[model samples]
Target: MTVLGHASFFAGRPVVEVPASGPLPAVDGPVAWRIDYPDWDNRTDETPSPGFRDRFDRFVDQTGESVQALVVGAWGYAAFNPAPIDQLCAAAPRLPNLTALFLGDIVSEECEISWMRVGDVSRLLVAYPRLESLRVRGGENFRFSPVRHGRLSRLEVESGGLRPEFVRAVLDSELPALTDLELWLGDPTYGGDTTVDDLAPLLAGQRFPALRRLGLCNAQIADDLAEALAAAPVVRRLETLDLSLGTLTDRGALALAGGQPLTHLTMLDLSHHYVTDEVVATVQATLAGVAVNLSDPQTPYIEGDEVYRYTVVSE
Candidate 1:
């Protein structure tokens, strides 16, 4: 369940990583293109590695016209690499058919979640008006501006620590067509400084009128968040609600179980939690019809009087 593995599929198409520098193979149906920075150590020549723009240009020349989805992985040294957001935005015209894009798809082996540096893709959203989905990984030095895209149905972000600014930008954004939204609000120690107030707009249910799936997972403040969502207006409209991968305890679970009825939801994912069996049973009974996932229950470290609970992905 860790987010360490590379994506096998995207935008309803199979993933195919484009060669670092070779003729792209033909005779394939629609597939998601994964453009990666060539591993520096693997290169035989002493020549410098190609920047993301060069690889992207090559991708554009080969199958840009036919490609419907694109994933950018390992732009350079994962610790300091900032994605070429401007260049990608400028070259949007070459890939008119692109309906989806994922940035910072590097795995943990290259760089841990908290160490990656990624930039904003709001410009790309503006450039690709037809894009239906967008996904991003990493959090360090990540930037995003509020944007509106008519066709965007899904927007997802994964980070070891998500900042408040990103949350504010997304909540302030007007995504009339967005149906799915997931943001991993990682631990504050890693740089996730987002507070529940920053998520006020989303909980208010004024933005993203079409949103049906809402996931505010991987937060250190899961209890407080559960308290907020216990009475949030957005919960009533959502078909899927994910509060997993966090340090949720019985306090939070009891609040949810005693709060508003979640009968309207079709799926409720509370996996990777610190709740006990009693609370788990209560939640299951409450949302009996929903596909509730209570897997990977965690135990807090109890030393003397203090207790410590951690989210599944804190790195």
Candidate 2:
């Protein structure tokens, strides 16, 4: 049988790629697993074959208590299926070592980033009590029911547009160990209803005391977000801050440059923005030791009567 996927590593941990064929790896210490079906778009329908589940079950059987991270790639196209999560949950007793998960790793070839459907992720969190990191891509129809997990430390959601309800769900969650939080607030056209006001609690430092890294990215109103973050108490304690893949302009860059708290951060990410070269230079100079990312500067354009600034990812 042809091996569908291969195994690799990131930061010394093993990463397993689940392809359409081949036997699951029996090696231990698999930190991540990516599920991908290359023939998804060409298939007659989106429903995955029984072989998919069989492979997953085999993976569970082979890895049992060793796998720590799971990355779900394209699965036959019909939105994303929660069946894998259900399978993992049902076998949680044997997979107690699982901790990190990245859902919806599909690209434009399989499905547009904004078009990928996301179901409620509450059950997944509840099932994995030892989960330390959870990253999800795509936001259409995404929902997160209020839940608490003691070991969850990193939470990231990337989307063309993030809904307010989802943000509210994170805000309401009881994650005492959460230290890294990244939310991609995409363009308003793709269901992004959250405003800076909705993030007031996080900005005010009234939540997530253990948070050391924060990312408020892929925003349309990045300038406003920067302004809010500049004055927020949360910035005072963050070790890393990310405001990338957004329409950030000089106004936002200035807010960060002028801010005192940002100087203390070890790293600052401001890539894929609309800031001028001069502003980038100024911000970089201000935060001397901080590793800054100021790549992919965007030029403002005019389409019809209104000015247009695009986010890095949008349908």
Candidate 3:
């Protein structure tokens, strides 16, 4: 086990703890991995610390048993070229067990269009051919064309705003057999713009055939829109749901609570909305058969700046 912290080009850099192999305790298997470091917002021409790269290479080379899943983030904020990242992946011997690649804030921040669109979604997708799980944020003018892959199981897109065309592209292609979908839209500064309309349209039809988990966050959406989106017959197996924002309202709640039996849902979150005590009570009563999480009756929605952020699950 090894953890590496890196600074791109910012001051007041804090020291990061790198993991060492030993009795560090057991973690879930299946190519499970994660990396955190400086993001694209702080890029410079300076080369990364050699020690940092060396340690990473060692992890891929000497880590016990092939890593089955990888969750990478914070770092790798340089412009998207695919070559460098591909080289890094190639340096490690073939990881036969590698199945999933979890990326945080890289697709949107690092590969940002303003920086330079060296590559599109196609490039990165090909670079990490074994990726099964992908999570990204802060993308601007980034267009992705979904490619076909057989091992992918989950895809999470967390952004201030997501384009409809790109969203459609995601559903069109079969990558690693995506089963879980999570999307976060809405930019506070530009509250409700063209982007809001572009958000859910990507999921208009049977885009995700195997999707089972859906999470929507911080978007200019309404209950009706959410209800209509959730009524997809193909997504009948959805097990976990998180709809937090003003977009999810009473009508959307009623639509979901009344329609479709989400039999597998174990974790359901409905927080930071305009839900009243009566509405919450209605949901609680309707969803009594299943475990649902609604905001406390006394908890009122705060105005100006009260956004619900942060929800992480590990298994």
Candidate 4:
């Protein structure tokens, strides 16, 4: 069953029931509410709006079942410069039912000067120790600490550059239940000089034991870096791998598919980048068992920027 917000156009009415006799797709178990609000970046006042938060809290209060996940836009008033973002994340631990958090536009210029404030979100992340999947967008201010949370299964890092300390934190946490992992470079500051070698030690070995789905988007992947992933055990169980965007050339492509354990991959997205059709074909032939998508013109590749997410999704 889907819960409609009182302010929603579909609110104040029961969800339409389907006939038992008719065929219907099974609902993906666990439902969540998505709350979107305005932002200052769009040329609004700098302060966040209160109306949005009021509506958001109302939706949560009316929600009956344990919310499997929550897709939230902004925390305070404006989605752009929300002041209460930390407050909402802090509430995550209280929502025992919440497991997954999908955040959007988390990093904006408003918090650029003091990225440390976003650390509040990190504290809330620890609250949901049983969280299964996590995706962060916008800025890279939030630090991933080594707080032990055994139930976390999947982790996706988008945009923002992660700190070296966070890598050790992840390893020390001992995420025994983790299965899928994704890392995309956003707003690259180092250019061609940036190598995965800097990131290897963080995720190389026993760190991500159960990782499966690996998506590397809009990052600079050098040949040696790609080879490093091939050598890592993290690539063994990957079922879906996406390496799209950025300045990845044929060298990186070959290194990734030359001889690796990414045989079970079912979906692959390689959009943008300078890798030619020949390189793609070579990777395909190398991993004949995996289904691959070379490119999607509609989604133009981003060079070095990151995407910030703040919405919650249902399980």
Candidate 5:
């Protein structure tokens, strides 16, 4: 499903947006502190209600070492800096216990997915050595370096068009504890430059042996991906395979149905697709034991001799 609101839960903790210049809530258990200017849609750089930096400072002042999870929301409407890479990296020492983080959690109202510009997120990994889960949203000006992270287990990047270099960097890195890897390979019209060939290392199971959930979703070349993934070495060991929010047709579904036996899987999400009802039955019959999400079957847009298929989250 499309992300319409703020994250309800993140990193196994319930999300609570804490205000600036306010008393800290009585945190009995772990909670993900989501920092952002209130009514941020109407907010501007001139507003007296604190900017992201001020809010972050307040949060750190109130609860520094105890903070376990954090989500960085809209930085500013017209403020000096947009991305919080510098502030976040600079304040890493103040947030020692952070294990889960979500950067650029701004919704479509604040900024479109393709309009966001994120810098080298590998710095976050380096800054938070004990981080277990990290999620980033955006694609434009996004970057990554092939850095080994030992304790990182879950990594999710929600993008309109993810860069091939970034994808390659992720696949090349060494994450001995990585279990969940979900990437949204969005529309090419919005700079989705990644190809199926770039995913070879992951499909071959060359890295991240502990990876059990693999989601190469929101792709334009889903049929090609399905063809390659049919016999990929990685699928055998995966418990969850999410090919959702893509342009997967009956042809791709048939390939998956006729390919390897995926009876071992616990969940298979193929939602928001264009597969026919007959093929849908075939897929359901093929992987009956698995919890397959075949919702929102789309009918391709037709104009004369041309047919157009689209992914779910492309803006």
Candidate 6:
């Protein structure tokens, strides 16, 4: 198992890492397969190494249809290339067992999160009908036309800022088995135009009947989100709520404490916020026994003219 640490560019936050266990055995169960850059040192170049395509082909050949949960990292300057999903789709027949796919596992050194240009992933979803979980990082030029898939249980899009159209596509799509949904509603400067109104369908509990976990994170307007979530019907039904890695402040924490009955939730993640220790303690006390994470409080500062507090990860 190779543990890869995903250290936050933002200060004070913990370095979260995922263990990559690879060279999977041909078994009839979930197996994690990692596809990394052929040459890590020269990843900034536009073209991939001659061996890169061969390596993926080799992986498909060796895995022999018993592979699931593929993690793709650094496809040699992915920002400049078409989405790697296209390539995976071409090899879909060989990876009949694949269910979970984590794309863009590239770190800051390989490509800045905001700089990673992703293309339409609709074809990839269509290619693999059995895909249950899809986690994608990077959002510039990202798109997904309305799609319907019965097996998808989790969909996580981690972008510096996600496009509103992508959010709309998810809302309009048919995902009957979707239980977990995480969207990083990043800074507006990076194309994140989704407002509280855009999330009205999800917040009203009118969509995704199986959704138990909801993450509206990495937001610039965390305070407004908190206020909206307090009154959202979906909050009452959720088992886990994540409002992390954003600019959540004391006002937001107060709204959560005073407005909502979050005791029903098993976990509430409000990590990487601008809220004070006192407010965090109060909120934790209010939601007693509800496994709350309020780490990495940001210290507000004054930039040239206006005071500023940033989301955890943005270019």
Q: Give the candidates in order of lDDT, highest first.
A: 5, 1, 6, 2, 4, 3
TM-score against truth, every candidate: 0.93, 0.89, 0.64, 0.69, 0.93, 0.87
> Which of the two, 1 or 6, has more lDDT?
1
- Candidate 6 Cα misplacement greater than 4 A, ranges: 1-30, 38-51
Q: Could you report the Cα RMSD, in angstroms, for every candidate shown? A: 3.0, 4.2, 8.1, 9.2, 2.8, 5.3
Q: Is candidate 3 or candidate 5 better by lDDT?
A: 5
Candidate 4 has its poorest 10 consecutive residues by lDDT at 1-10
3 or 5: which has the higher TM-score? Answer: 5
**CA shift of 30, model 5, Å:** 1.4
| lDDT by residue for model 3 (39-92), tens | 344435544424435555656665434565555444445343221344345543
lDDT for model 1, on a 0 to 1 scale?
A: 0.84
lDDT of 4: 0.52
**Winner of 2 and 6 under lDDT:** 6
TM-score of 1: 0.93
State the TM-score for model 5. Answer: 0.93
Which residue pairs does candidate 6 place in steric collision? none
Model 2 scores a C-alpha lDDT of: 0.77
Q: Residue by residue across 30-88, what tens digits does model 1's lDDT show? A: 88888888354543332323576688788799875787889888876656556677778
Determine the backbone clash count of candidate 6.
0
Per-residue lDDT tens digits of candidate 5, residues 52-146? 67877878988889889999877664232356777888899999999999997877776677766577888899999999999998756788898
In candidate 4, clashing pairs total: 25
Give the clashing residue pairs of candidate 2, or none: 4-21
| Tens digits of lDDT, candidate 2, 41-82 | 444443444555676777677667867777766655635433
Worst 10 residues of 3 by lDDT: 1-10
Q: Which sequence of candidate numbers ranks them by TM-score, best first?
A: 5, 1, 2, 6, 4, 3
